[model samples]
Target chain A: MTTSREIRLKSRPVGLPQASNFELATVDLPAPGPDEVQVRNLWMSVDPYMRGRMYDRPSYVPPFQLGQALQGGAVGEVVASNDPDFKPGDIVSSMFGWREYYNASPKALAAGGLGAITKLDTHGIPPQAFLGVVGMPGLTAYVGLLRIAALKDGDVVFVSAAAGAVGSVVCQIAKLKGHTVIGSAGGPEKVAFLKSIGVDHVIDYKATPDVVAELAKVAPKGIDVYFENVGGVHLEAAINSARPFARFALCGMISQYNETGKPEGPPNIIQAVGKSLRLEGFIVSNHVDMFPQFAKDMAEWIKAGKITWKETVEEGVERAPDAFVKLFTGENLGKMLVKLA
Target chain B: MTTSREIRLKSRPVGLPQASNFELATVDLPAPGPDEVQVRNLWMSVDPYMRGRMYDRPSYVPPFQLGQALQGGAVGEVVASNDPDFKPGDIVSSMFGWREYYNASPKALAAGGLGAITKLDTHGIPPQAFLGVVGMPGLTAYVGLLRIAALKDGDVVFVSAAAGAVGSVVCQIAKLKGHTVIGSAGGPEKVAFLKSIGVDHVIDYKATPDVVAELAKVAPKGIDVYFENVGGVHLEAAINSARPFARFALCGMISQYNETGKPEGPPNIIQAVGKSLRLEGFIVSNHVDMFPQFAKDMAEWIKAGKITWKETVEEGVERAPDAFVKLFTGENLGKMLVKLA
Candidate 1:
C-alpha cells in the first residue's frame, strides 16, 4: 500500500476558482492487479479548459466531479506493472493527472478508452513536452491551422494569446509555412517572447488602447486567417481586420471562461456575413487522427531549431491550483505545468 | 424612344428604411448601341440584402449610390438586340433592377462583369422564378447546404425563416434527401406554408416564448445542420439545439440588418466550441460556378413535381419600395417580388 497526494475538487467555482475550492488529499493506493500498471506522475498540465471542467456544466469534456480527484494530461514513469505490455521504469503519458500516482488496467490504456495511456519514446526530448508542445496543445495548433483554417502560403495569420502554448506553436507554424504571422499578448514581456519566436508583428494588447485599430495599422491588407484563443475584443479585432473569405479556427475563448454571468459576445459578428467569413469552433480530441503526422512534423522542427517552447512550471503537486489560477491572469509565458514527485 | 420608370435611392436610411427614402423617376430609354440589347423588365426582385447595399459600406457587393437607380436581379424581355447571341423577344435576366427598362452593352453582359445579362430559357417555368427559386436564392440554398454544410443523409436540418425564399428551398431539399427537417417562421400562415412544403416540424416563433426550448422539445436528438437566415434569437436557439459537429450555413442575418445600433450577438456562441460547430457565412454570387448544376437539378425536381415555389409579388414598380420595406416586418411569404409592366 502507498499514499498518493492528489488535488480534489472541494466545490464547483462561481467564477475564478480559488485555491480553497480545491483540497489536497492523501489517497491510499493498492498494489497493481493483473493487467494493471502503477504510475508515478512526474509532470501534469494546467490548461484554460480546466476552468470549464471546474463548473458543473456540460462541455466538450465532462465536468470534474466534486470531492473527486481532478484529471488531466500527465507524463509519468511506470513504477510497477503486472501487464506484459508495460514494464517497470517505462515512461508513459496518461490522462491521470492532479495526482502523484495512478493504477491503470489495459482496458484504460486501450484505443478510445478513458485515461488513454501511451508509452513515450522521449527521443531525447523532455517527457514534459508530451503535456504541451509535443502533445495535445501541439496537435491542436497543427489541426486547427492545416485542416480547420486551410492555411495557405502568403496568408496573413493573426494569433490571439500568442504567448500561450497553442498560440505560440500556431505563430511559429504559420511563419514556417511562409505566411506573415501577427501575434497579440497582454504585456511587453509576452510580446517580446512572441517576437523572439520570429512573429512578424507582436501587439502588446496591454498598451494598445484600441486593438482593432492597431490590427488595422499593422495588417493593412487584412488577415486571411485568425487563430482565435482569446475571444471578446480579440475576436472583434480579428473580424474587423479579416479580409473577405478569411477563415477563423476557434479553439478557445479563454477571456470569457471565468465570467460569472453570460459574457458579452463580439458585437460585430454580423460582419461575418459582409466579409464571407468562416468561423469554426473545434475540440482538439476530434482531430486525434492527425497526432502521428503532427508528432513527426513537430519533432523535425524541434531538431532543426525551427521551433522553440517556454514553460512556466510550478514545483510540487500542492501548487497545481495556483498554476491553474495563474493561466486566467495571463501570468504564464507559454505552457503552464506543475511538476510532481 | 420609350420612357422607363426607375426607382432611385433618395437618401440613406437611419433605421428601418421609410418609403420616402426612395423616389420614382421617368428616364428616356436610349436605343441599343453596337453589341447591345434594350430590355423592358417584366419582373424584378426586392430582397433583404438590398438593404445592406443602401448603406455606404464596403461589403461582398458594392453599396448602392445615392440618387441613382438601385440594381438587383430582374428578368425581362429583350425588345431590341444588336448582339447576335441575344434576339428580340428573348427572355433575359440582368442586374439592372428597380427599373422598367435597361440597355445592356456586350461589356455589361460579358462573363463575370457587373450587370451581366444572361438569356433565360424559362423551360416552361414562370419567368419570375428566374429571380427566386431558379436563380440567386435557389443557388444560395443549394451551395449553402451541399458545399458549405456538407450535409449528409439522415442529417436533421433546422431552417430559420423557413417560409422565405432560401429557407423554403432548404427545408424541401433536406426533406427530399430523406433527412428530418425543423422549420421556424413568424406567424401561423408562414408555419402552415412550411408544413405544406413537407417540413417535418414547424415552430411559429411569433407564438413561441422560448424558441430554444421549443426546438429542444421538437428535435430531441438535436440538429445536425442549421440553415441560418434569421439571426438574433433564432441563431441562439439553433446553436443550443445543435449536436456535436453540427454545421451552420449562414445565408443571411435578416433580424439585425435594420437595427440602428449594433445588433446583439448570440450569447451562446460559446456552445459552438463544446459542440464542435462550424458556422460558415457565404454570399451566393461567389458560387455562381454551381449555376449550371443547380439549374439542371432544380429543373428536374420541378418537372417531376418534387419541387414547388410560391411568390408574394407586388404589382407595379411604384410599390417596389413598399415591397422592400415589407421584408423587414416579415409581411411576405416565400419569394418577394415586384412585377413591372
Candidate 2:
C-alpha cells in the first residue's frame, strides 16, 4: 500500500490566508514499521513563517494542528528503507512538509534541530535548493547578517525583504561585505530585483509615498544594519533611518502576517532611545549553530557567482494553498516553492 | 564678579512643556577662566532624561540650546580653582546644570565623559547622592540591568518607571538579584512605592485599563527583564509580556518624552519576532565603563539597607520649571530634585 496526498489544516487562518484554509487529504502507507522511513515528497516550503503556525498562539514553533498535516520545508526521497539512516535513493531534508508521502521514525524524522531528517549533499545544488537558497533562507541570511547584526566594518546594510527569501540573502551579504546596501521591496519587479543584486539602494516600497521619506532620501549618512524582513512601515523605516549604534536584525515580520488586530507597532519606536538602538529578535531554529559554517559560506557564495536565487514554483499538491496565498500577496519573488512530486 | 541665575531655553517645546517653555537668565560670572573650576550650584537634576535635551533633533545628548544654559545634573561647591585638579572646596560634579555658577575649562569640563567636572568623593553618600543614587540615576540603573539586560539567572524583572529615578534603581536591582520583579508605576503613591521596594509584582499603570491585560496579569511566568522606561503603553506591555530569550533594557521613554508627534509605537512590536526579543537601546554616557562598578555597587546597596531612594524636592532656582514639569505629571516620586542653593 502507498497512497498519500496530504494538505489538511482546513481552517485556522483568520487573516490573509484562504485556499479555503487548505484541505487535500488522502493517506495509506504501510510496510516499513521497524525504524521506519518511507518518504517521497520532492520540494515543498512556502513560508512567511507559516503565518505563525496559523495562530492558535504560544509561539516559537508548535501550533499548526487543526485537521493536521501542515508542517513545512520538505525535499524528500527515500521510498522504503527500514532506516539504517535512510537508503532507497536517500536525499533527505524534513520538517515533514504538507505531504505527498511520509513514514518517519528516523528518530521521528530527526527531532527539531532545524527540523532534522538531514541527508542531502546536493553539491551541484538545487534540491529545491534545500527548500530555499542554502536552505532555511540561507541560514536566515547567515544568522541575521553574521550573528545577529554583528556584521561590522562600515555597516550600512538595511534590508526589509529586499526582494524576498531572507531579503535576498540579506542583499547579497551586504553586497559581499563591502557594506553599503539598502533595499526595500514591493513593486517594479521587486525594484528590478533589487537593482539586479548589487542593491546599493533600492526602495520602491510600492513607489514610496514615504517609507520614512524613502528612507531619508536614500540613507543620508544613516542606517547601520537593519535586516528586519518587512514589519509595519518597514519598522518605521528602520527606526527613522537609524545610525548611532543601530543594529536591528529582527528577521521575519512579513508585515504583521495578516494581522487581525494588535498590529500597528513602530511609530519611530522612540527612535530606539535617541538612537542607541539594538532591536534583535531572532529564530532560525535558534541559529542551528550556523550550520557547518552555513554549509561552507554558502558553497563559496554559490560557486563565486556570489550567490543569487529566486523561485516561485507552485506546481502540485493542490498548488499548496496557492503557494501560501502568494506569501500575503506580494506575489512571491524569491523563494515560495511547492513542486511536491 | 558673580551673579548667576540661568535656566534658558525659553522656546522649543510644543507638546507638554508649557511654563512658557522656560527662561530665567541673569548671568555675569567670570573668574577662573584659565584652567577654570569655580562651581557653586547645590543640587539640580530634573530628569526624564531632561525631556531628551528638550528636543531640537540630533540626539544622544545635544539639543537644549535655545538661549543657552540648561545642561543638567549639578551638585556644586568648588567656588574657584583655576584647576590643579580642583581645590577651593571641591565637592564637584557637573554638567554645569541650569544655573547659579560657571567657570569651566577642566578640559571643557572633561570633554563629555559623563559631563565631566569630577571631584566628588561623597562616600558617606548624599551630595544629592551624587545627583541621585550615586549619580546619573545610579549609572542608569547599572547600565540597564547588568549590561543591557544580560541579567540572566532565573530572570523575570519587568520595571517601567517603577517609581522613577532610573526606575527606583531598577526595582532594587531586580530585588537584590533574586529576580521575580514586575513594578510599573503611577498612582496610589507609585503603587505604594512599589510595595515599599521588595516588589515582586506591583503594576498600577494608572489603574490599568489593560496594559496588555495588566502585563498578562502580573507576568504569569513571562517577562525576562524588560525595564523599558514607560514608552507608550509601557512598550505595549513589554511586547505583550515577552519571555523567550527576552531582554529589552531601553532606558528611557518617559511615555514618549512629551510627544509632540511621532509616538504610537509598541503595539506588541511584533512580539519581538515570536519572543526571541532583545530590544537594547541605552546611553548612560554610553556606559561610562560602568562607572567604577556603579560606584562600588551603590555604596554597598546603600549600606546594606539594600537600597532605597525617593526625592521630589523643587525648592529654589525658581522651581526649575516646576521641577521639569513634574516629570510630565506623574508628579515625581523618586529623584526629581531642584534645590539650587
Candidate 3:
C-alpha cells in the first residue's frame, strides 16, 4: 500500500472561496487491479472554471461534491501498470487532479471513453505544455476564434485577459493569421507580456478609467471579433467598440464568477440588435472533435518557435487551492498550475 | 403642382415619443423632374424598428434626423411619370412614408439600388400585403428563424410578441416546419390569436407573475429556439428555460426602447455559458437577398391557407404617429399601419 495526499471540498463556497473550504487528506492506495495503472501526478492545472464547480448549482460540468476529492486536468506518470496499454514511466494526462496519485483504467484512456486519460508525446517540449498551450486552453482559443467567431483575413480581433492561457494563444494565432490583434490585461506586467506576444494594441484595463474609450482610440474602425474572457466591464467595452456584424466568442466570465448575488448583465446588450452582433457561449469539451487538428497545429507552432508560453506554478499539492484563488485575483500572468511529486 | 402633407421629427424623444416631438408640415411639391415619378401614398407601415431610427445614435440604418421627414416602408400609386419605366396608375413601394406624396427616381427602383423603390405585382393579394405578410416584416420572421436561429425539424421554438407582425409569422413557420411552438403575448385576446394560429402552447405574460416558472411548466423539455422581440423580463425567462445549445435570434426589444435610463439586462445571462446558447441580433435590411425566396414561399403559404395576417389600420395620414405609438402600448395585435389617401 502507498499513501496519497489529496484535496477534498470541505463545503460549497459562498463567494470567493477560502483555503479552509478545501481539506487536505491522506488516503491509502492499494496496488492496481486488472487493466489498471497507478499514476503519480506531476503537475495539475488550476483554471477559473473550477470556481463554478465549487458551487452547488448545475453547470456544463457537474458541481464538485462536498467532502469529495476535487477533479481537474493533471499530467502524471505511470508508477506501476497492470494494463498492457500503459507501462511504468509512461507520461499521461488525466482528469484526476487535486490528488498526488490515483489508479486509472485503460478503457478510460480511449477516445470518447470514460475519464480523460491520454499518453503524452512531449516532442522535446515540456509535458506541462499539454496542460496549457497544447491542451484545453489552446484548443479553446483556436475553436473560439476560428469556429465560433468565424474569423476571416484582416479581421480586427479583441481579446480580454490577453496574457492568460487562452487569450495569449488567441493573440498569437490572430497575429499569425494576418489579423490585427488588440488585447486587454490588468496591470503593466501583463500589458508588456501581451506586447511580447505581438498584440497590435494592449490596454491596461486597471490603469484606464474607461476601457471603452481606450479601445475606441486604438480601434477607430472597430473590432470584428471579440474573444470574451473577462465579462462585466470588458463585455460592455467590447460591445461599445464592436463594428457592425461583429462576432463575440463568450469563452469565460471570470469577473462575475464569485459574485453571491446575480451580477448585472451588460446594459448595452440591446446594441446587439442595432449592430447585428453575434455572441455565443461555449464549453470546450463539446468541441473536442477539433482537438486532433489543434494539437497538430500547436505542436508545429511550438516546434518552429512561433509560439511561446508562461506558467505560474505553485510547488506541492497543498498549494493547489492557493493557485486557484490567485486566478480570480489576477496574480497569475499565464496558466496557473500546481507541481506535485 | 401639389401640396404634400408630411410628418417631420420636431425633436429627439427622451422616452416614449409624444405629439410634440413630431410636426405636421404642408410643403408645395413640384411635378416629377427628369426620370422621376410623383407617387401618392396609399398605405404606410409603422414597425417596432422605427423607434431605433428615432434615436440620434447610429444603428444598422441611419437615425432619423430632427426636422426631417420620417421615412419607412410605404406603398403608393404613381400619379405622374417622367420616366419610361413607370407610368400613371402604377402601384409601387418606396422608402418615403409619413407623407402624402413624393417624387421617386427610376434609378432608385433597381434591386441593390439606393432609395429602395420597387414596383408591385400584388398577385391577387392586397398591395398592403407587400408591407406585412409578403414584405419586410414577413422576410424578418423568415430570416430570423430559418437563417439566424437555424431552426431544424423537431426543435421547440418560443416566440415573444407572438401576436405582433414578425412574431406571428415566426410561430406559423415553425409549426409548418414540424417544430413545436410556444408563444407569449400581453392579453387574453392576443393569446387566443396565438392558439388560433396553431401555437402548441401560449403564455399570457400579463397574467403570469413569474414568466420563467410559467415557461418551465409549459415547455418542460425547454426551448431550442427563442425568437426575442420583447426584452427585459421576457429575455430573462427565455434564458432560464432554454435547453442546452439553444439559439436566440434577437429581432427587437420593444419593451426597453422607451426607458429613459439604462434598463437592467437579463440577470441570468450567465446561464448562456452553461447551456452553450447563441444569441444573435439581426436587421432585416441586411438580409434583402432572401426576399425573393421569402416572397415566393410566403405568397404560396397564404394562397394555400397555410398562413394568415392581421393589420390594425388607423385611417388618414394624421393618425400615423398614433399608429406608431400604439405598437409600444400593445394596442395593436398584429401589423400596425396608417391608410393615407
At residue A278, candidate 1 shows an lDDT of: 94
- What are the models' TM-scores? 0.98, 0.38, 0.98
Better of 2 and 3 by DockQ: 3
Best model number under lDDT: 1
Each candidate's DockQ: 0.73, 0.30, 0.82
Point out where model 1 deviates above 4 Å.
Answer: B106-108
Model 1 C-alpha lDDT per residue in residues A1-341, reported as the tens digit of each score: 97899999998887888988999999899998888999999999998988889888767788999999999999999999988888999999999999999998856568763258889999999999999999999989999999999998778999999999999999999988888999999998898899898999999998999999999999999999999998888999999999989999999998889887877777788888778899999888888888889999999999999989999999999999999999999999999999996
Give the per-residue lDDT digits (tens) of candidate 3, residues B1-341.
99999999999888998988899999999999998999999999998888988988877778999898999999999999998988888889888999999997867566543256788898888888788988888999999999999998778999999999999999999988888999999998899889998999999999999998999999998999999999988899899999999999999899989988978888878788778899999988888888889988998899889899888999888789989989999999888989997
Location of the lowest summed lDDT over 10 successive residues in candidate 1 chain B: B106-115
TM-score of 3: 0.98
- Report per-candidate TM-score of chain A alone: 0.98, 0.38, 0.98
lDDT of 2 by residue, A1-341 (tens): 89889898978988888888888988887877988888898988989888888888878778888898888889989989886867998889888888888887878746658777888989788799888888888888889888888888988888887888888888897788788898888888888878888898898777788898889888888888888887888888778888888888898888788988877888777778768888888888878887899889889988999888889888888789888888888899999889878
User: Model 3: how far is A290 from its true place, Å?
Assistant: 1.3
Better model by DockQ: candidate 1 vs candidate 2: 1
DockQ-based CAPRI category assigned to the predicted complex of candidate 1:
medium
- Candidates ranked by DockQ: 3, 1, 2
Question: Model 3: DockQ against the native?
Answer: 0.82
